[model samples]
Target: MVTSKVKQIHDFGQSIWLDFIDRKIIFSGELKKLIEEDGLRGVTSNPAIFEKAISSSSDYDEDIAQLSKSDKTNEEIFFSIAVEDIKLACDLLAPVYNEEGVVGADGYVSLEVSPFLALDTQATIKQARELWRQVGKENVMIKIPGTESGLIAFETAISEGINVNVTLLFSLDRYKAVAEAYISGLEKRAADGLPVDHISSVASFFLSRIDILVDPFLDQKGLGDLRGQVAIASAKTAYQIYKRMFSTDRWKKLAEKGAVPQRLLWASTSSKDPAFKDTRYIEALIGPDTVNTIPMETLQAFRDHGDPASRLEEDIDGAAGILERIKVAGIDMDAVATQLEEEGIDKFSKPFQQLLDAIERQK
Candidate 1:
């Protein structure tokens, strides 16, 4: 039986996705059991995740040894391993992906592109296309950042029918740009008479990281009470944007032609503050047509004691007031988001290199 907490999330029309993944879970049938018993609907992986799985595990040694024998560079070997694991993951989730349901519902895995090319539109597009082809799974979503360049790369990638997961988005403005790219891509596909039925994408509005970045500023400014609250306020505001964007006449036209609205996926949901509830991000953001990707720590916490609720819509006025109050308090949210996004790119890119270096030493 699906655990009531997780099942209640599904029953409320939101999907729960596991934020952690490795070959062990896939091969040991743990991923399958999560799907069966916990209502796990999708999987998301990044360079940091791959780094941890590759560096810390004896599980990947034999495969890495075999892969290292090839003439490919360590980076190439890393992707070869990642693609295979993603293929396995996609197959594991095929039942959910194939179910006839909503236009944009997903049972999928996300594979991120090299973050080093985040600012280079053409390069990002080329690599994303290559990753998409290499993974060769219809259920695979090529992950890209929501940089100025990444937005264009996204539309281009989607125009080519490659699903995209737009990561590292922080501001409402950036989120709107991502939604625009998604709709423009689908519109181009429809204009060319191409099928738009299966193209899936998500604007990943990260949660905990925002609070991590903003909370210090709040404390420094003597607004300590607002410490753990900025991220949720930002997220709820973004969810409102998601609703408005998908309800526009333009989105309606795409929907009529079978295009699915790109859902707002809440990423980085684990609370960084010990004072905050472990499931603070997940429980607060629950809503229809949204996804909350929870790391194992947060997921287990939520499963143990989460009280699910329709709270995304509950504090609309209060959320608006919080953001406006934040602005009046002299913390520049746009600046914080900018710093976090730049750091986020490095945060992902560095691990990938470290993972490769670890593999090189083992080889």
Candidate 2:
């Protein structure tokens, strides 16, 4: 029997997606079990996760060797391997897709466009189109960063009726921007006589990273107890933006045409600060039309002993107060958001290049 904690999360209307992906999880049937047992609805992947998978496992060695002999560049080889994994995952989750009506179980697998192209709107769009085609799965979402250029690519991709997973959003402003991009894309698709109902998108707002970056500043300024406060506060405010955006006349028009609300996704929920509760992020951000993509350790922790409850809606006024407190503590959140955005790109870019280097070494 699934634990009441896990079941309650689903009952509360939030989707729990596994943030990490590997061949072992996929081929060994572990991923399927998570879907069946834990209500795991989706999978998200990036260069960092893929780097660990390919470098740490022997699963991709033969494919890497064969591709090295071809004229394909290291980046191409990497994407090819990632696409294979995505295709396998998409197939595995197909039943859930069929049963859940596109928004539920077996929702989609996300493969990010090259982090190198995060700033190039045209290139990001080009690469996203190629990735969607290469994966060849109806349930595939091309992950685009929420950078300015990426936002543009996101708009174009949605306009072209391609599914998108907008990643790295750290602020309400950024999340709203991404939502607008999704809506704009849907409007464009609707105008062009495309099926707006089929185009899907999610704005991924990372959690623990916010706390990781802000808590220390809070501590140095005699606000150490504020550790783990910024992330939830930021997310709650972001959901308010989500609620307001989707309720607008513009989005209502698109919704009438079958456009799904670009749901807010909580990413990086694994607790980085050992001082905090293991399930801190997950338990706090529980709300409707949202997703919490937990890493394996966090997932198991929640499954084992988590006291899951419907806490997301319990503290709306308090959540707002938390943000105000942070600002009063002299932490400029707009500056923090800017820093996080820059660091997010660099963080992914390093691992992406590392994956390329690892592939080259294998060759």
Candidate 3:
């Protein structure tokens, strides 16, 4: 009876959150088993995940059919069902959530605002707040993209005490900006005599996708040896940024008011290429005050044969060197970040519209 590898990860301080969710697991008690057996701490959902769940299965048909009979718009209908699923997930995760006047605790179920709102600051803020109010669950986190406009809404949402999981982050510079926005929001709230305790956030960095975009370029540059290495090195570098940002006098002041530092969460963690180990991302990035939100396949792969360790802070100087060499190779990392951000929005928006179209077919 060896300890489960996924459960063993908790000993090193990294929480394994399921990145995929469908009503099937929630209602079937499979989700609960993951919590109990695998030590799963939280869940994350996106439009693409929901799109696959709803369109590929009959689990959502009755709900969609009933909602269609009403005068509600397709978007309205989708959220109605999405909210119910989120609430269910929140309830399941509530036990692990510590809300005793504490901030930045885990066990949250995240729901994203519309991906289409990523570029519209005001609309992103409006939808984020609306979704926050609609779900009305303390353990539920509303995910906003980390785009330029999304960062504006993120700061505002944090100030308003809405827990946010900032998604689609790519560059180190943008990650720092996201951290600044979180701190600025808490600072504003504390200045206004509002309670800063209990607000939670995680700056999610899309990992494997970084390599997916950069590998071919590396190949052409005769730097194919660096194919799977860049994403891990970038993440290690980002973890260093996290440590520095949260150790400042400014962040310390907020901590005194019970504000918890936003943690760095690894997203898009599943390996896309079969040439890499299934647990390539997870094995390299395990550290405290961090999370790795993995898809079900990766989750199962880890539970079966993954090795758990605290390696995120390893090879610090080497990590920096990897990034520097990539720059010297004439790769514009900033340009790559911008392209990934735009593509990430479209990745979600297309599936979102498809989900809406599927609901329209119900009529």
| Model 1: residues with Cα > 4 Å off, grouped in runs | none
Scanning candidate 3 in windows of ten residues, the lowest lDDT window is 98-107
Tens digits of per-residue lDDT, candidate 3, 179-220, equal: 999999999999999999889999999999999999999999
lDDT of each: 0.89, 0.87, 0.94
* C-alpha RMSD between model 3 and the true structure: 1.2
Quote the positional error of residue 182 for candidate 2 in Å: 1.0
| TM-score of every model versus the real structure | 0.97, 0.96, 0.98
Give Cα distance to truth, residue 258, candidate 2, Å: 1.0
- Candidate RMSDs in Å, in order, are 1.3, 1.5, 1.2
Order candidates by lDDT, high to low: 3, 1, 2
Cα shift from native, residue 4, model 3 (Å)? 1.1
For TM-score, candidate 1 versus 3, the one ahead is 3
- Clashing residue pairs for model 2: none
lDDT of 1: 0.89
Q: What is candidate 3's local distance difference test score?
A: 0.94
Task: Give the alpha carbon lDDT tens digit for every residue of 1-363 in model 1.
Answer: 445687689888788989888988988999998898888999999999999998988988998899878898888888888899999999999898988765248797999988778999999999998999998888899999999999999999999999999999989889999999999999999999999988999999998889988988898888888888888898889888888999999899988988888999999998887888888898888999888888888878888999888788877988998899889999999999999899999999899889989999989
